[model samples]
Target chain A: MQKIELEISFFGAFRKYERTGPLRLTLAAGAGMAAVKAAIAEALDPAASDLLKVSALADAQQVLSSAHVFDTSAQLVLLPPVSGG
Target chain B: MSQSPDTRSIHVCVRETHLSLEKASAFVDAGENGAALLFVGRVRNHNLNKPVSGVSYDAFAPLAETVMGEICVEAQAQFGPDLRLYIEHFKGYLPIGGISVIIAVGSPHRAPAYEASRYLIEELKKRVPVWKKEHYLSGDSEWLDGTSLVENP
Candidate 1:
């Protein structure tokens, strides 16, 4: 099985719970978004574990649907609700 | 605000540069449209009794743009095809009175222009994937929940 690299990031209040800066994770190419999201939750400091249930996910160009598969390059981000006007 | 030749609407963006009303309005110019309504949002000097010094925003750019575009498209549809839309947001640091967001709508009448502009702004605030950290004059900073529309968990 081939592995795909996804550059992951946390935004807003999630930063305080982040273990480190932007992370690049390699996962099996066939992984589902749920699996990827689980991995992200596992990577965060324990205090941030709850955010996984609500945080939105997106790539560099668009929001990723929940059923997305890991078949392409991923600039993954965990987004909280936005407040821009 | 950017007036990309390919994207005249300039409907979505997240950047570090200051927002420009001129650029936003120009992007949505409808030559024969009777009204071009432009709304500029600025960081307020006070909030919750705290004197705010400035604000810094961060965004999940790709998703932010995508949602912003959708809001613009939806507003156009609601208002009418003749109406054009433009939306832009500035990230990084912006002091009190600094422009944070811009929404411009060009429409055939003042009613639709005003209506669409309000919808675009409210929807933008509710949906765009951008967050702001407020810096207080007391030298303390906190991330005020930007998503007032949703009860944050």
Candidate 2:
């Protein structure tokens, strides 16, 4: 078994956490989006979990689903509900 | 028969700069197109009775632009290929009355122009990867609620 480090960025209401830059998390290799979400929840306070539950994970190109598996370190982001007009 | 919008005829961007209605109108302008509709979204002085000084916009620029392009393409495909569109969303902080977003549509007729303009704005609100934080005069700020993009399991 091995572990990988990921830099997960935040957006929208989550920007308050961004002041510290992206949240760094370590996950087991071959992890998927669900595992990533769980790791994020574990890293932050419980209050953030509600928002995290609804937020979507994305790579540079598109929104990723829970089924998306990661085999290596990645730069990702958390996109909360969008409010742009 | 209508086809997808020509990539050249569609202009979409997400930038941390002022959004210009003039640019939007100019991009969608065409001699053959008789109708040009412009929808500008501005930062107002208040929201939900809270006096607002301004607003700060944050966006995932790459995906926001992509989503906007897709909306414009879809509008043209439904309205007609002759439809030309310009869509932009502003990022960064802005004082009250600053333009936040603009959607311009040029079409051969008013019907399609109106429809396309409405379609673009509505879809942009729902799909774009952008967020708004309102700054209140009371020294408080909050992010407004919005349509979610997350997929439910």
Tens-digit lDDT string for candidate 2 (B1-153): 223336779999987877877888889888998999999899999888889999999999988887888888898788988898999889999998899999898988999999999999999998899999999999999998888888762
Off by over 4 Å in 2: B1-5
Alpha-carbon TM-score of each model against the true structure? 0.84, 0.93
Chain A accuracy as TM-score for every candidate: 0.84, 0.90
Span of ten consecutive residues with least summed lDDT in model 2 chain B: B1-10
Residue by residue across B1-153, what tens digits does model 1's lDDT show? Answer: 322222555467777887888877787777788899889999999989999999988877767787788777777667786777888888889989999998888888899999998998888888788888999989999876655222333
Clashing pairs in 2: none
Candidate 1 CAPRI category: medium
Best by lDDT: 2
Prediction 2 TM-score vs. true: 0.93
Report lDDT per candidate.
0.77, 0.87
Instruction: At residue B138, give the lDDT of candidate 1.
Output: 90
Interface RMSD in angstroms for candidate 1: 3.6
Interface RMSD values, listed in order for every candidate:
3.6, 1.3
